[model samples]
Target chain A: MNSLKPFSLLKRIRERLDLQIALAILCLATAFLFVGGYLNYLRAQEQERTGVITMVREMVAVVEGNAAIAAYLQDLQLATEISAGLQSSRYISMVSIDIDGGGLVSTGAVQSGRSPDFVLELASPFSAAETVGSIKVYADLDYIEKLAASKGRSVVSGQLALLLLVSVAILWAVRVVVTRPLGSVVRQLKKINLSDEGSINQISTRSQDEIGYLADNINSMLSAIHAAYLSEAEQSRRIAQLERKFRLIFEGSHAGIVMVDGQNRLSLANQAFQSLVAHLDPHLDQQEPRPLSQLFYDPELVEGILSTVRENNASVFRDLKLAGEQEVWVRSLFSLIESQNSAEMGYIEVVFSDISDRALIEKHFEYGATHDQLTGLLNRRGGEARFRRQVEQAQSRAGSFVLCLIDLNDFKPVNDIYGHEAGDVVLKEISLRLKSALRADDVIVRWGGDEFVVSMLAQSSDAVDAVGRNLLSVFEQPVEIRPEVWVRVGGSIGIATSDRVGFSIERMVEAADEAMYIVKKGDKNSYQVFGDSVARSQSQA
Target chain B: MNWMIKAVWILLAFSGSLYAGDILVVVSKDSPVDTITKRELVDLYMGRSHSLPDGSPVMKIDAPVDSPVRAEFYQALIGMKVSEVNAYWARLMFTGRATPPMSVTKPEDVAGLLARNPSALGYLPEDSENEQLKTIFVIKEDQGAP
Candidate 1:
């Protein structure tokens, strides 16, 4: 009883519009036919009555003289003949002749003893002074009644046939023009492929009726739906492609990236991100990131991001580090990601990169006290010294400059799978390529292993990108480390220029870092430039 | 149109006239009577009395029901419609008390039948002539008679 649901049978019938309309018409037609047939039957009864009376009257008129003669003769046989002639009428039950002097002579087909319908009498006179005898005519109703009944039956049958034919025609016409068409439309609606825009167009009947209007309205509605579906499909396809590229970048980059939901649970984390978190706490690799406070070496960054997002919606830090034996450093950017409805800030997106070896960050507080011996290029310290010199020169002299970060592709496999001797040889080969590709005014610095920073004294952003592209093209062909020992390496470069407005040395380097991440995120072995306007626009984004 | 004419004839016969002709109350030349009044004529025709004014047993001769002259005769004599006269006779006959007048479809037959039965009485067209029958009275049609 608890599981049973009540369905209304009447409601189900009411919902069928065609049945409702057809029944209404059929009921009206049946009523008209019934009334008309009944009236016709009544009229036939009257006609049969009149005809029977007229026939009996006519038969009496024909036999009047003979009946008088028979009555005068007192001849029973002659009287019987007069009565027999009336038998042909089928409506006479008896005929009688009576004379005062001669006894009554009567003859007829007697009924089963029921009263007669009517009696007719006429005087048989001997001369004018006396009526010597009389003739009596008795009429039976059976023949006229039978005839009337048959007439009624024929009328009824005719009316019924007419009603049946008319009803059949109405049903057929309705099925062809209304029910079948509507049924097809309903069936068409049932199987419509909502995803396909062309599925909206159907019902090719050309008419100016209500059904046509319905079809027209449906066609217009389908067209609108088709247009919306097409536009949405294009939008979703583009979004999926961008999302795939975004996921590839977030996962494939040397940096770690993750999203924490509004509940502070790790909603998304890629392999590099997992490894980075594992570096802080190794046991986090196989477990779901519940109680996010435990997954982090210090929960302060997440808590700060949450508090700031509650008020300002987003916050970023130049650099934050985890205290450990191997110092882990990252420059973090945080923002509150919103739901589609835009009614509330739903979650947080935190993007961070391994900036641990930015020892130049410390040197930016000092000057020129850094160098690297392995590749005879300036280390992080010298790179910061040269960057400060360029900043000061640009502010005082009002000159322009471009800063770029270049990351070596496939360097880890060469160093880890091969040996350090092969790694050193590969690094020296890249150093020689940079020397040959650059102008003498360009300052090149190897900031760390498999990382380089370059400063070109150029204001235009496009020329900076051209220089970056030239550097990438250098590594397109493999380098020869030994006799007939060939190895392939690719480079991804990020460029930024001080030519546009809002250019600080820090922002320029951050823009360059962001652009380098883009090249590594998509199809690799490419270069990208981040101009000042683009960097400023994306700072909040 | 034929039935309409018949209907008009019947109406004229039963209703006496539309301010025009009159009827001749006729009897056999040997009827042994001279004349009769309209009151006596009505009694003899309606079966209220079965005898003539001369105290002889009487028989009435009539034209057929559809005959215009017969309708006029009854209307003029007894002031009765054909259906009323037929009903009266039907009731009398059913009770075995009296029979209606002997009838012929032709007015000529009515005059001939009256000639043969001296105790019989009938009406005829005013201009009709017969050697064996005699007209005893001429009843004016209606109130407009001069």
Candidate 2:
């Protein structure tokens, strides 16, 4: 691992921007230099060759006159001397002079008739136009070529050096101008912490080139990202705070709040909701989500509310009577919490509040409205309501009931002798005795100031007379108004059977009242049957 | 304009020396050669040939190296300066094949030498009082003239 680390570092350095740019420039420059240097070498070679040719021409011109005189004389000795002189030059490989009609004088090794580089026709010494002989100077071609090649190589070498220097300079300039600043900007970006309250640091560059422009754009982008991040954080903070507030409302409410899933199982419940369920079923303490229906005594009531709320997408209000010895009543609201996404089902949110106190108060008001405050029995209004219900039952079943209407005899004289308070005491004592005489299911009413009514289900006329005799015995006993002050008040009784008068309570009461008045005119404190009185009257007529 | 005429007169005087000459090619009075052509005379003195035009062998004579008459004789014959003529002969001296004319070292010794040998050839100024030799050819400033 240790040995490989430097190799990895070297690889990373090779991948650096400055080194990569330098390598690219070096490759391109080397290619162009190769091409340009080759062209320059060819040009130099050609120029040097031309220069060598010109030098050889000048050498031939220098010795032309001497060669001509020797040719004209045809002196073999003089010709040989001139050839030797010309051969001394490095550019001349061989010199040969051919004298007309004479032998040829030569210097250096004469090859197999090789053509000379330069040929001059010699003129006679005394005449300008006379043709004498020819002088041939063979130029050293190998030496000339070598000279030209050396010159061309020197020129190409100079160009290559210049190209290398320029490439190095360009690589340095690019690193300074572009790559280093970009690396600095990247490092600055990495250092930025968006969560901090401080502003993002901007990259500093003096040059007004593209790198500076890039720094400006990056700064703007960083600020934008930072701003977005900050706002998102603040929004989440507010959402959490709002969630806490809603949680307080849920937990601190007097009303029980419960959230149940679509499967009728409890998903969430506040403390109040759990307490309310504890009242219904105190032993229920399993942690796993139990069915919300099990929390209610009447599961059907909860099912009805859930169905109604689900159908209407609205709230349902119901008063539930929980089953227990304690008269526990609850007002419940079940609302459908709509699902935000279409794919999921809605939840049912229920709120339950204990209304038992209010229910008991309402029951008291109802009892006070129907019963008589003085005697604790059904009053005239209450008796009429009962009488109508009894008539309805008798008609529906084809059964018979006897209605008795009773009025006290000489009760006003007792009220005149004793005070009204003493009259109330006598009335209370009579009501107790009347209640004791009849069956518990019998309907009794205080019909007027001195009139009392009793209704009992009867099947025959003998049963009707038996109830009439029992009610008359209630008034036979005297009620003691105060200590040692007693009042004896007899009641005149008139009995009517439902079979004779049909199921109309008003008709039955009228028939009984007329019989009681007849009893009051004849014998006070006696009993009379409504139909029997009519028969008795007819017998007398 | 006066200076210009002076310059022209100067120029004419210099040109008169270049074009006019007085030299004569001669031999012994008793020799067969008389009134020789310039070409045959050139061949004898310049060493292209050792014989006269008639094909008889002959000896050639010349004035001393420093003599003004010798300078004029060769100048009128070949249109060359004295130094140029010496260089031309020096080239032939290397070959040992052709030789230049024999010199007498004194202008007075040329007549004696020519009188001793009939086949001898020599040259002198045209006004020279030498009865021992005869004029074979007249040399002039223009060597091309016939």
Q: Which ten residues in a row are the worst by lDDT in model 1 chain A? A: A532-541
lDDT top scorer: 2
Reference contacts preserved by each model: 0.00, 0.50
Runs in model 2 deviating more than 4 A are A1-20, A54-69, A88-90, A110-113, A123-131, A187-198, A204-217, A228-541, B1-21, B28-40, B53-55, B105-116, B127-136, B141-146
Error of 1 at A19 (Å): 13
* lDDT tens digits by residue: candidate 2, A14-127: 868887787788889888888888888889989988887788778768778878877877887778878888888886788899998778988986467688878889887765
Q: What tier of docking accuracy does candidate 2 attain?
A: acceptable
Candidate 1: tens digits of C-alpha lDDT, residues A145-224: 88898998898888888888887888778877887777777777777776874646565555568877897888789778
**Superposed Cα deviation of residue B9, candidate 1 (Å):** 39
Per-model DockQ against the true two-chain complex: 0.03, 0.35
Instruction: Please give the lDDT score for candidate 1.
Output: 0.71
TM-score of each: 0.43, 0.47
